[model samples]
Target chain A: MGRWEPNARGRLEQAALELYVERGYEQTTVAEIAGRAGLTERTFFRHFADKREVLFAGAGTLRDDLVSAAAQAPPGAPPIDVVATALAAVAAPFQGRLESVRRRQSVIEANAELKERELIKLASLSAALAETLRERGVAEPAASLAAEAGIGVFKVAFGRWVGEPGGGEFARIVREAVDELKAVAAGS
Target chain B: MGRWEPNARGRLEQAALELYVERGYEQTTVAEIAGRAGLTERTFFRHFADKREVLFAGAGTLRDDLVSAAAQAPPGAPPIDVVATALAAVAAPFQGRLESVRRRQSVIEANAELKERELIKLASLSAALAETLRERGVAEPAASLAAEAGIGVFKVAFGRWVGEPGGGEFARIVREAVDELKAVAAGS
Candidate 1:
């Protein structure tokens, strides 16, 4: 939010990933990344606040997409459906980019610290979803439960969408996942 | 697993919460906690791995309860229902302890590091749930999805139960949460 530098952001992300792969998240330094990006340390700061920021820097964009989609869903939509639509909207950027998604997940997997941060990010998203549902007049506990359930579905769908060979469409997989939840809840 | 000292374990937990509330999680140390509990730091380590563990050092018991319950759910139980039943069994020890829970939650809320650790713990629980679901013939994504959704219901119910002055019951709230998910799935 401070200094607005467009190209530096992408440059920093790529640089961070390269270093993370070659060295490690802990071993990678902001200064080293900025140098690789042909930018000064301050320039790197202009985009990401810290080394960890490079990993989660796009969370805001995804969060906004999720919230906006939920907001735009039809008036009578249930909380889970609204969250599903939001996840679909957010999946567009990652769709067909399995290699990148896998790499990001790999980085997160190699370190428990990174995994904890990722978990916190997911928790925050669920909280946001619950808040949005509450704003829509959903009752206590339902809004939060529905939001958490939706995130669970998203986690499952995304993991499959990225891990499977020639993975099916991201949106399609998510829709099917939702239907599966419905079936489980209804059928059993 | 180290010292088979049950009362010592309880003492360490009580001391940790007192200090965390008095000083802070980061500021508190294993030695200080042990001293307060009239034990050596070695005894504290013998009971729990470290300072952070004092809060949920009972995870081993909780896990056993969950696994045993999941192992025993009716063979034909649905994925969500199975997970829900397991969660209910695991939450039994936590019943009638709302005041203690609210205090623990406050300590967690005050510390980001603690919250992060809590998230990691939840992720582990979710993975365990997925594994248990696999033993029941649930497919890959379905197993993970059902597990995560079950965690969702647990979180929502636990959140409400602890916050309510006279929450009906932990198991009751959990069932209510599952019912809400069913209603949402069928609602829109």
Candidate 2:
């Protein structure tokens, strides 16, 4: 039904996620995903390198946007503020996609391979963000520390946003997480 | 040369790390490592399930020690302090093994599969640490936030200890990293 769909990439992803949730990630195959999307295996391959790519396709853009946002922040802004702004900016597009994000996370959590890939992607993003902080003249340990803390806040906030019913905007949740992180660090 | 050696595990690990660094992680084989250690392949298997295990043999103990330290921290101690103490405890044993750690890190960094495994192990350690924090009455986001920050500190400190000559004791570096984390968080 979706083979001829205007947004073939989106349709293929939805089909893959639905299939993965129903049959489990390992049990789902590219052919089945394509069939469910009313597309062909060729089309599926064209859109995603593999089933795993469907879940991780956004990672590249997310990393790029986060680095750019941090790099473009005012030079005098505090490291945490710069990181928080970067997180907020990158998180803006995730708004209104809570259900999708939730489904994807569950699928990832259920599979070890997917979980490893997710962690690696997150690590890569953190490294890129840290590099941007360094570019802004942030010192060693501080740059890496800020970047890791930023990712940690993003993870905690994203988990809450996806799991809670009618969760508030993603950016707001991230802000709360950043505040909590500072408090946690300060031993408050 | 090492067949009759009393410390079979240590001999095998040293042989494996040498082979891995000299021949690359992928090029080194279990048989080669065993031969280098002057032990039969059977003995190597007796010690480690596989080549990768030789590199990760410490992960389980590291996780256990970290959790125990966190769990036993003085009641009412701050979460970050608890985490810092846990990290220091786990890092103590690594103080005199800087060269070994550096060799292993270089091998891990050179191979994508090994790198993924390393990240996954670190993530597991973080989860266990966070759970211990929860047991100590730290709440949701704070537990995870503190744990991630602690791991961040450990990673930064460990990298420095392994890469820099006379980097000082592992525990001291951990303490410095923890301080930097707090400063980074407070935007000092």
Candidate 2 docking band: high
Question: Which candidate leads the pack in DockQ?
Answer: 2
| CAPRI category for model 1 | medium
Regions of model 1 farther than 4 Å from truth: A1-6, B1-6
Q: lDDT of model 2 at residue A179?
A: 93
Model 2 clash pairs are none
TM-score of chain A of each: 0.90, 0.95
What TM-score, computed on C-alpha atoms, does each candidate reach?
A: 0.92, 0.96
Q: Give one digit per residue, the lDDT tens place, for model 1 in B1-188.
A: 35555588778778888888889878888889999988888888777877777777766677777778987999988887888789888877788777667778889999898889777778788898889889878887778877888888888888888888786678877887888878877764
Report residue A151 deviation for candidate 1 (angstroms).
0.9
Candidate 1 is scored at a TM of 0.92
List the global CA lDDT of all models.
0.81, 0.90
lDDT of 2 by residue, B138-163 (tens): 99989998988788788888888887
Tens digits of per-residue lDDT for model 1, A1-188: 33455577777788888888889888988889989887889988867779988889888887777878888888878777887788888877788677767777888999989998888888988888888888888876778877888888888888888888897789888888888877776745
The RMSD of every model to the true structure, in order and in angstroms, is 2.7, 2.2
Candidate 2: list runs displaced more than 4 Å: A1-5, B1-5
